[model samples]
Target: MERTERFCRIEMLIRSRGCVSFADLMTELGVSRATLKRDLDHLRTRMDAAIVYDRDRNGYRFAVTGRQARRPGPPEASGVWFSEREIHALLTMHQLLDGLGVGSSMGRHLQPVLERLQGMLGTSDSEARELVRRLRVVPPARKPVRGRSFERLAGAVLERRRLRLTIEADDGSGERDRIISPLRMIHDGGIWLLDAWCHESEALCRIPVPQVRAVQTLELRAREVPMRVIEAELDAMPALRAA
Candidate 1:
């Protein structure tokens, strides 16, 4: 198994058992003693695991307030810690993805990554939901969008694919079809926009999500854009542009 998978298993084992012996971890994970020790060290130092070895108990466990005095393990090492504000930010993002319509392909693409972050934060979806309730985000001045329209744009962006988008026009004008190589998906001022290379225009453009009436992802492979170009375009956006 991969290192990340091993890390998840280790966390589950220790959390479920309250304490776990190195020998037990080796047996369960089928990893050598050195690897197990390194994993434990990494978890405690990098991931904010409240863990310590207990000499008398001959195992590792989460540190408790009074238990530390009697257990007598090594001093907890200092490392990066997640602040409450950071957690709140993560939870807010969790809320955004969770609110997407069910069975969305883009949501599926993101689930694994989101799950790992949730595990690292030691938070559940229910907890995130409660947090979302407490801190509300009211979108301002955004036109309502059809659910399917949002899904198509998101799926295309996540998959790094081109899309055939039907752009609607005003003054009773008919819609026009354009094939775009999606570079990024962004939200601003309560509206969703896609930064893409338009085949019709032969230039980079930002398409408003609400104005997209229909979308279809092409089977053809997506054209790759350079990292420098994407970064330059992102920096040139109105929000990031220097006055």
Candidate 2:
């Protein structure tokens, strides 16, 4: 993994696990003790990550109460924020987006906002343009079900609401009406899946959006579905199971 990826992973680990010992970090990262110590020092000095020694825990911990002081602020607001490595990572993401063919649309719509970000880093427009050209990103394939239907189903799933769906055959033969409680939306192998709970079956199901002919929101509330059960069903799917 790249240094930036490692740093991001370390930050996430700290946030999720609270205090982390040197030995623990070494074990998790498979890095030498000296390397882990250097990374810790780099985070403290460059990223403003507050790592304090906890004698009782026998590890390094981020003091939650004083976190604000240690966290780097927005660049323009606080010129002292973000080290060179952080800036490089940010630029890399922009470059990746550019390479993905979405950059033209993003430049037309989101470039203005990104201009402010560039200003914070003291990077000129020409420099940003150059960076975009030099870096490349390959985006994954587009999924089925574009436009309004996709948006509606996504919203319903996010809000944890029930949806009245009509699944129609491609041959225009039959339709099935279902009241489904949306659980999760998964994008896999260039396909979008709405993992939901079918009230009629009292079981979890995966609905491909393209097969859904019509979708409408229902006043009926969503019911809690066990994540493990839903995951098991998903794993049992022929395509996923084959993989």
Candidate 3:
């Protein structure tokens, strides 16, 4: 696992198990003794974690007191903890959003959040800027979009609204209109897809964004399906005939 994932996993293991032995941590993380020691040291020193070696139990555990400094609001609200690679991934996603042409207003809104992320990696503004400048994300060429439905579809998905769509049949059949509840939008294999609950067929369907000829957002709220149900359906038939 990557160091970021390992760090999160370590925190979870410690919290859930109360005290995790070195051998157990090593087995769970699948790292050598030296590497695990280094990770623990980094967590305690760099991350300001309240990890303490428990001699009584011969394991590591979070300190009972004085582990975390008193801060305003809840812990989730106050902290933005992330590793260097995760920050780079976020920056890359930011670039992807910019490339999607919705970045004008959104970028302005997200700029401060990105800056905060950068702050976690550096001590000063200049250092953060310098660190961010070192990484560049180059997105691959995507399939040419056929119509203006991309923006409307994205908005509908975010707003949890129903949609009236005119999609070109993949089998060379003419356009078909359908009412669907937008569940999620996915970008896969350089093409965008809308996964939704089709009202006509009463099933989940995938619609290629490029195949979308027309889109109309409805005022009615979209149907909500549990993620587990979606995953189960997806697993049963990896490929569902598109709408």
Candidate 4:
């Protein structure tokens, strides 16, 4: 694999596991000891990653959190570099998600990863958070979207596949599952809604991201909806035209 890809995997692995052994990283990345050490050293010294080797654990961990410091814009990029701007963007994103009361998947899983990345941008997590809070978004409704649900929806839309959604029904019916052919995602203020072809309803409907409890991927062989059909159905929705 390319060096950048390897670096990402390393970050992801370490983030998910809290630590990873040298042998485990080597086996997973399929790289020599020298290449691994070089990448780790570059991340620590150049990118200012807090990856530290714990002799007791015999692995690496980011080892820090909290935000406090002015974040400069990214410097010129060459390779394997994450800019301060990117970090700030994520900081802002997490802030928004928090206001929206997005669900546990993003709150529990993704936030720490972003927090760690923010900490890597040469600031405490709190400082990175301060940078995000500097710009405020008006308060948003609490919809409880799963952490990874938004990302999975985007992937489903890009791949033109069906998404199985566990969402709240609008009619006081509480939650139910709907298989949908997702076409578009609309961001209204701090809210995210999906426009899709609902198999159960046999029509287009708005699926709120925050209301989504889970998103499941389908097999490749599952029947896929044509984008043209989705567009046509979307065009026919009176609410869409009214907007």
- Which lDDT tens digits does candidate 3 get at residues 67-106? 2435432222123457877788887777677555444536
- The candidate scoring highest on lDDT is 3
lDDT of 2 at 61: 67
Q: State model 1's lDDT.
A: 0.68
Model 1: per-residue Cα lDDT over 153-202, one tens digit each: 76777788888888876433778888988877777776677778887777
What TM-score quantifies how close candidate 1 is to the native fold? 0.50
TM-score of 4: 0.49
How does model 2 score by TM-score?
A: 0.47
Report the CA-based lDDT of candidate 4 relative to the real structure. Answer: 0.68
Candidate maximizing TM-score: 1
Task: Report lDDT (Cα) of residue 199, candidate 3.
Answer: 98
Error of 2 at 2 (Å): 20
TM-score of each: 0.50, 0.47, 0.49, 0.49
